[model samples]
Target chain A: MSDDGPRGQVGKDSFEARLKSAREKQGLDPKASDPDKRLSAPSAMGVGMRVGVELVSAMVVAVAIGWALDRWLHTSPAFLVVFVLLGFGAGLANLWRVMGPGRMPGAK
Target chain B: MPQLDFGNPLLLAQVVWLGIIFLVLYLLLSRWALPQVGAVLAHRAETIAADLDVARRAKEEADAAVAELTRATREAHAGAQAEIAAAVAAAKAKTDAESADLNAKLDAQIAAAEERIAVARTSALGALEQVAVETAREVVGRLIGSSLDPALVPQAVAGVLAARAK
Candidate 1:
């Protein structure tokens, strides 16, 4: 068959070819992907623990200083009692400092 | 160890001295250490609050910047989509117009081809009719042993040509 002529056969062939090309162009192809995660809790807890340790250290230092002062004064039990109580007060103050803003009960 | 005399006036006086020392220490702490420590703590708290405020403001500003960028990005995306849609629509419209033009051209070509075919067929039929008439005349002349009219032949040919033209 002489199907290469410009009338019946050639027109039908061109229309079919254009239709197939359009369908191929409009085809959809999708792909899958992943998402990300975050970490915050452990780090915040570590920071809080560090602050507590600092307050305790300050209290220990205050107590040691009071003991040394009592020994220097040579007042035996008298200075020891007074200095220890002062150290306790200083420790509570240091704890309050670490706590920040809000006052702790029995601290005064 | 020997028992210390807790009932002795000297021991009681020493105990009273210790109590006095504790009172003095308490007074000193209440007057000096507490205020100084409280002041330091208040200052630190203020500093922390200021830092937190600064951080919060910075975060808010960053958030605002991100929001603005997102809005701009969305707007840009929408604009690009609109542009793409417009381009596609224009292409479709142009394609439709071109197809219509091609269809009209094809129709014209088909009509011209049909007219040419019709003309060719009419010409071929006219030639066939002339041949038939010439053959008939020759056969008739041979059978009758006489020559046909030359003017009648021309007139018959003219009539056949006119009929074919219609």
Candidate 2:
């Protein structure tokens, strides 16, 4: 523009032509064809099933501990009730943690 | 009930098998499956991040290009407008100059025409005075039965006409 010469006009025209083609190319560019297309670990249903298994496993471990204690201490019913109730509460707590809002998605 | 008895030797065997199975499963998951799954997840994350990076760069480039285009277009538009204004100014100046020249010519013509009318008016008044003096000379000669001098008749007409103007 400052030159007001032939070369400046040529440069401006070429630049304008490039801009027009670039705009066309930009339109043609396929944007991020598969952005989130990746191997994800699991779905919500899978996570839910794992959480249920964790809850059940917690109760099963408590039951086993209670049974072993009863067998060793020779006190059967007394520990059974307390351990079973404890196991039930532990299972509930495990379920709560697994399904919590802050829990990571697809957590094992 | 017998199967439930912890004192049975079969219970010891069951516990050993359970430990062996758990160990094998743990190894399989920790050493093999978990790493494979983790690697896949990492690869996916890297791919997504790379795509996002490319997208950000492209967007920045596009924005800069668009800004450059807008600046160029504005400059071109301003140039065109200035050119148009210059053309209009040139035309207006030409028209103004032409009209000024025409006005001067018309004024000269009008002055010449007015001078001609003034000269015509003076000659017409001089002719009317001559005619009045001749008529008076003829009538006075008839009434008095004597002829009047031409110089005297003109002098008398001049006095009458001068008094009429007053």
CA RMSD per model (angstroms): 22.7, 11.5
Write model 1 residue lDDT over A1-108, tens digit each, in one string: 135335754655665565444434333112232233323234556646755665566656766766777789866667556656766676567656745564322211
Please report the candidate that would top TM-score against the real structure: 2
Model 2 / residue B107 / CA error / Å = 3.3
Q: Candidate 1 has which clashing residue pairs, if any?
A: none
The true-structure Cα RMSD of candidate 2 reads: 11.5
lDDT of each: 0.69, 0.79
Q: Which ranges in model 2 have alpha carbons more than 4 Å from their true place?
A: A1-108, B1-7, B52-103, B134-146
Cα lDDT, model 2, residue B47: 70
What are the per-model DockQ values? 0.01, 0.05
lDDT of 2 at B66: 64
List the candidates' TM-scores in order. 0.45, 0.45
